[model samples]
Target chain A: MKLHNPITLLLSLTALLLSQQSIAAPVEYIFINLWDEYVQQTPLPDPHPDIERRFLHPDINIDKPSVDQFTALFPVYDGLKIDTHNQLAIRYGVRQTPYRLVVEGKKVITREALIKAPLAAHADQPAQDQTLQTLSGHPFDPTRPGAGFRVLFFSDSLCPFQHIPNCERRIAQNNHLSANIDYPVITVIKPFYVDHTQVSAYQQRFNVNHEIVFDSHNQLFRRFEVTDLPYWVVQNRQGKVIYRANQVPPLPL
Target chain B: METIMKTNLKTFLTGIVLLALSATASAKPYPPLQARTLADQPISSSGKITYLKFWATWCAYCVEEMPLLQQAFENSQESYQVIAVNVGFNQTVKGVKTYLNRYGYRFPTVFDASGSITRQYRVTGTPQHILLDASGKEIYRSALLTDELRQHLATLTGDKL
Candidate 1:
C-alpha cells in the first residue's frame, strides 16, 4: 500500500469522471453581447422601481421580475461583453451593438438580429441541408422534422439604402410579415462590413422576428449563388428551393 | 502487482486529459489576406502591423473620418501599413474615386466590391478600424474614431496626434 498507488488511483478516478461529464454536458447556452454598453441599456420602457434598485445595487437579494422573465427563456445565459479590443469579437465578426447571439455549443442556434422576408408563396419544394447555429449554440438542421417550411433570406447588412430605396422598403414590409407570421423563417445575413452588433441594431430598428444566422464567410451565399442584397428563397420541408425573388411576396388574405 | 499496473494506467490517462485541455485553450491564428489597392498595386501584410479602415462613400461618418486615417497613415512611416478598404455594398468604383479625389488623401485604398475581404475581417459598419500586430494577430479594433484611439495610434507609431 504505497502512497503513489493511492494517489494514482484518485487521479485516474477524477480524470474518468471529468471526461464523462464533458462528453455528457456540452455548453447548452451562450448569450454573446456584441456591445456591452448597449446590453446594459434598458430594453424595457419605464422600468419598475425594484428593477431599477437591483441595477443600482447588485448586492441586493431582491428578485427583479424583468430579469427573471429573461432568465426564464434562457436558463444558462452568459453574456460576452465584446468590443474591438476583445479578440473573440473580431473572431466572431461583431460589427454593431446589442448583438444577441444564442448558441447551444459550437453551432449557432439563432440570431435575434436576423429576420426573414417572404418573397412569394409557391408550391412546396425540398429543404436544403444547411447546418446553421441557433442563438443558443444548437445545430439547426432545416431538414429535421418540425422545422416546417423555411423562408431563406439572403441580404447584406451594409447594402446602401440610398441607391436602392426599394430594397429598404421591401425589408420593412418583410420585417412586419416575419414578426406577425407564424411560419419558420431563417434569415441569412450576408456579411459585408457589418457584424452582429450592427445587425442587431437593424433588427431592432425594423422590429424583425426571424432566426438570424451569419454567413460571414459567404459559404452559404456562394452555394446559393445569391449576389444581391435582400434576396429571398423559399424552401419546403424536404429542403428544396421552390421560389426565389428580389421583392417581398404578397401576404394571403 | 495489480495495484502497480493500475497506478501506471491512471497516470497515463491523466496526462492525456491534460494535453487535450491545453490544446483547446490555444487561440487560432488569423487567416491570410490578399487584395489590390486603388492604384492597382498589390498590398498585403508581410508579418508587419497592419491597420484596416472600413469605409463607404455613402456613410457620412466614414467620409468625415477619412482625414484622421490619412494622418495616421502618413505618420506611420514604415512602422505600419494603413489600408482604407471601401465597403462597396451597392457602391461603384467611380463613387469611391470621386470621394478620394475630393479628400485628396491618398493612403493605399482597396475596394471590397464583392465584400469577400470585408466578410473575412467581419466588419459590420463604416469607420471600423482594426489593428493587427506584426504576427498578423488582431491587437485592437474599434468602430468609432476617438481621441483615445488617436493617442494609442500615436504611441504605437511614435507620431504626434
Candidate 2:
C-alpha cells in the first residue's frame, strides 16, 4: 500500500484537522440576567455566585434588559421601574432576582439545570406540564389552546395588608375589571398565606363572576412566573402570550 | 387675571402640602427584623435610629454606593447605626466575604440567606434604603440616595456631607 502518496497524505491530514477543530469548537451562549436593582439591594438569599459565574466564559455574551414602562405606584427613584412589566422576565419565566437564562444555539438552559450538570452534554427538553385543577375540580391547563383569547388574572384574596379596606377595594376593582373583559378571564388565587376557603369567600365577597382557580401549590404561579399580585397575562387562542402587565390592560370594546 | 393666577398658584401649593402630609401619614412602622450578621452574631435591638441598606455584588449601583455607605456608617456611629444587608441573590457567604475583604468595607453586614428580612420589609429591588427612628417607625424609604437622606445624615451625625 503506497500510503505515502501526496494526495492521500493531504486527505488524511485534512480529516484529522477537521475532527480536531470540531472537538475544540466552543459553544456560544447569550446570558440573559433578569434582576431588579432594589431586590439586589434588599437582603435576599440569591443563587450562588460561583454557580452563576460558570456562564461568564468568553463564549457567553451578557444582555441586560431595559425598562420601558413606569410601573411604580410611588416611584422610589427618578427612573425606578419597579412593578413594571418586563418582557424578558415574562419570556424567560423569571420569578427571582439574578435569574439567569443561557441560550446556546436553539436550546435555553435554566440556572437550576445548568447548576446541576455539565452544560455541554445536557439535552434540551420540553417543560413538564403541571397538573392544575379548578375550584370545580375540572382539570385546567393554561397552555391548552382554547376557542378564544384567555386572560390569566393572578390575584391574592387578601393584600399584603390584610386589615386595610383598600385591600378589599383593590380586590373589587380587579373583579370588576375581570367582569368587563370580553375575553375569558381565569382568576388564579395565590398560594402564599391564602387558602381555598379564603378564595371561595373572596369570590362571594367580591362577587367575582369569572372562574376562580385556587393555586394551592403555586404551580400556576411558577408556570407563569408571577412575582406580583394583580398580574395579568393575555394569551391568544393558540395559547401564546400576546400581552402581559402588572396592571390590567384596556381590552377591545 | 393676576388674582386668578394667584388663586391657581394657591390651589397648587395647597395640593402639594396635602400630598406631603399624606406621605408623612403613610409612613408605617418598620417591621421587626430577625437575622444573623456576617459574623453569625444575632442583631440586638437598639434605641438609636437604624439605617438599613440592601445591596448585592451584581448590582453596579449597589457596589458604586458602597464607599458612601461606609463613610455614612463610620460618621453616624454615635447618632444612628447602619446595617448593610447583602441581598443574597446569586451570592454566597464566602463570595460576600471575598467582596467585602477586597473592597475593605467594614460596615456590619447581614447575609440574608433566606431573604426573609427583605421580604418582611417588602423590598422590591436593590439599593433600597430604609431609615427607621428610635421607635422603629419608618421615617424614610427610597431607592435612590437622595439629598434629603444626606441632609438627615448630616444633621444626625453632625458631619456635613
Candidate 3:
C-alpha cells in the first residue's frame, strides 16, 4: 500500500480534531425531583432504555464515569430518580422537583426557554429599570450600574402560607451569601393590599439583612411581569438579567 | 316538701342530660394519631384540647415558630396539650433529634415519618398550627403566627398571655 500523502494526513488530522470538539461539547441531563409526589411514585419512567442498557448495564466493563459524564451520557428524554431527603438538592437551592435543567458547560438552560426557542436564542438581556421606594422612604433603583450583582427578590408580606416559608429561606440564603460573598440583595415587597404595618411585621419576622423596599404601585411587578409571590430576579453588574425564577438562586460560588 | 324534692331531682337529671349532649356535640373525633417521639415514647392526643403543630427541622419558618410553640406548650400544660408533630417527609429521625437537641427545645415532638398524619390533617407546609377543641373538632388552622392565633391558643389553654 502507498504511504498516505502529507495533504491526506493533514485532512485526516483536521477531521479527527473536529470530531473531538463535537464530543467535548458538554450536553448533560440534570434530573431534579421537585415534589414529594414524584418521589413517592417512583421508579420513574425510563425514557431511554437503550442508553440505560448500553451504559448503565451491570455487564458493561466500562469504568464508572464521573457524575458530569454520566449525566452527559443520559438521554434527554430520561429522568433520574433522586432522593427528596438528600441535601444535594437543598445545596443546589432546589425547593421542589420536576425541576429540569439542561446544562451545557456552566450555562443553565431553563425548560421554558428550551421549549420556546433554541438554546442559543436565550441570551442575557437588560433588566428593566423601575422606581422603587424603601420602607424608610429612600429612593432605590435596581438597574443602576454597580460593581457586583444585585438580586431583586419579590415577595408578598401578607401572603400567609407559601410566601412566608419562601421568604424565610430567601433571608437565610441571602444572609449566607452576604457573609460569604459580596452581593447586594434588595427584597421588594409586592403590594397585595397590604399596608406598611403588615410589611413591617414581615420585615421584623425574618432576619433580613438586606434593604426592604415596598413596591406599593406594582412598578417592578408590572415591569418584570411577576405574577407570583416570592419570585426572584438576579442582575449582573451590567444591569442585565442573569437568572429569574421562583426559587432563590444558589450563590454563584 | 315532696314537690320541692321532685323539682330538684328533675332539675338535676335535666342538667346531666344537657351536659352529656353538650359533650357529644362538641367533641368530634379526630383521626387517630399514634406515633413515637424522639425519646421512643408513644404520644397520642386524648380528651383534651390539642394543638397539633406540624413542623420540620429544615424549614426556616418552622425553626422560627418553635419558640412560640414552646411558649404555648409551657402555658397550656393543664387545660390542653401541645404536640409538635415532625412532618418528616424529607427528613431523618436523626436529623430531627439533632435539631431538637441543638435548639434545646423540650416541646413533645412526635415523628410522622410516612406523612400519613400530615396527609390526614391536610398539612402542606411546616409550622402549620391545627387547633382541635376539647371535643377533637378542629377549631383553628393557620400557618401564621398572629395575634388571633395567640388569642385562640390563650382561650383554649385559659392562660392569660
Candidate 4:
C-alpha cells in the first residue's frame, strides 16, 4: 500500500488482522478527528512548525494522535466535512462534539463523556428539547467575577482577514463587528490553518489584544459549531451564542 | 461675451468629467496578481468556465463532497476540467500535503500566494463554482454545486464542464 494513503491502509490491515484474531477481540478503531471544528475558531500557533516537522520525518510513531503531532494526527480528518458526525457535546441541555458513539448492531448502546473509554450502552435522549436560557459550557453565575462574554474568534494566521483580495468579503464582514461594545472577546489563535503568515500579518497590523486561547487540537472550534473561517461568535456575559455571523450549520448533503 | 465664458466653463467641466470616467474605466476593481509558485511558475490558466470553484484544505465543504468531484472529473475530463484550486498561501506545504492525501483531492490545484487569482475571480467562499466559456469568460456562479448542476454540466460539455 502507498504510504500517502496510510489511513486506508490501516483500515484494510485492521480488517485482515481482526479476521485472524479471536472473535472476542475488539472489532476496529476509527479516529474521527474534528480538526475542521478548530480551523474556524483560531489561527495556527507557534508550536505548529516543530510539530509539523516531526509528522513528515517518516520515523515517528503515528499509531496514536498526540498533541505535538498536529500535522500527521490531523491528516485523517483533512478535507473531511462535518456532517459525518453530530454536535455530540451538549451542556445546559445542549449537545456538543468530541462525542464517541459505539454501535454493535441496530440498537443504540451507550455514550460516555470520555473518549479514551469506549461506552458499553447508549443513554436515552434528554426529556426537554428546548431550554430558554443562553448556551453555557460551564455552570457558573453570570454576575460572578470573570463570568463575562466569550468571543470565540475563529481566525488563522495563514488565512488572515486582511488582504483577502476583496472577493472574500466575509473576512471584512467578520471584522466589521464593533468589538468596542460590552463584554470582552475570547480570541483563539489558530496559526496553523490555511495560511499562517496572513494571520500573523493581520494580528500585527490590527494590534489585537484580548482573551487569547490556543487550539493545537481544534477542540474548541468544534464546540462552537463554526465552519467557515474568520468566524465570530458572541456569547453573552452568560456564555451563550447571542449572535454569530458565521455559525456553520449541519451539512445538507 | 458672458455666454462664451459660460460655454468655456461648461467645456472645461466636461473635459474633467471625461478624464475621470476614462481613468476609472482603465482601473481594475481587483487587479490581477503576480503570484508565482515555488519553482517561480506563473499560475496556470484557469480552464474555460464561467464559475471557478475555489477551495482549501481547511474548508469543510471542500473536503466532504470531494469524492463526488473526483467522480465528476473522471466522468468528463476531456471536454471539461474542474480545477479545484487550493488556498494554501498561508498554510505550510506539509500541512496541505496531509490534507490532499487524506481527501484524495487529485485535481490540478493552482496555488494562490498573493491572492491574485482569488481577487481576479471574485470568489468569496470555499466550494464556490464558476462556469467559464472556451475564451475564459464567466457565465454562471453559485456558492454550492448541486446535482442539477452536475447533470447540466454533463449535457453542456457532453461530458460535464
Distance from true location, Cα of A54 in model 1, Å: 41
TM-score of chain A of each: 0.43, 0.45, 0.44, 0.33
lDDT of 1 by residue, A19-54 (tens): 876554423222232112222432422323422111
- Please list the Cα RMSD from the true structure of every candidate, rounded to 1 decimal place: 24.2, 26.8, 24.0, 22.9
Q: Which of 3 and 4 is ahead in lDDT?
A: 3
Alpha carbon lDDT at A245, candidate 3:
69
lDDT tens digits, residue span A36-109, model 4:
32333222222323112111111111112222334444564333232211112111111222333332332224
Lowest lDDT sum, 10 consecutive residues, model 4 chain A, at A53-62
> Fnat of candidate 3, please?
0.02
lDDT of 4 at A251: 16
Mind giving the per-residue lDDT tens digits that candidate 2 earns over B72-160? Answer: 98888669888899867557799789878977988889997755576667675666788888877887776545556777888888776
* lDDT scores in order: 0.57, 0.61, 0.60, 0.44
TM-scores, all models, native as reference: 0.35, 0.39, 0.42, 0.32
Q: Could you tell me the lDDT of residue A181 within candidate 4?
A: 45
Fnat of every candidate, listed in order? 0.00, 0.02, 0.02, 0.00
The lowest-lDDT stretch of 10 consecutive residues in candidate 2 chain A is: A116-125
TM-score of 4: 0.32
Top TM-score prediction, candidate number: 3
For model 4, residues B1-161, the per-residue Cα lDDT tens digits are 99999999999999999999977754423222234443345543444442246765545445544666676666654666556655542345566566566656665556654444664675645666666665565545554444346666787657534
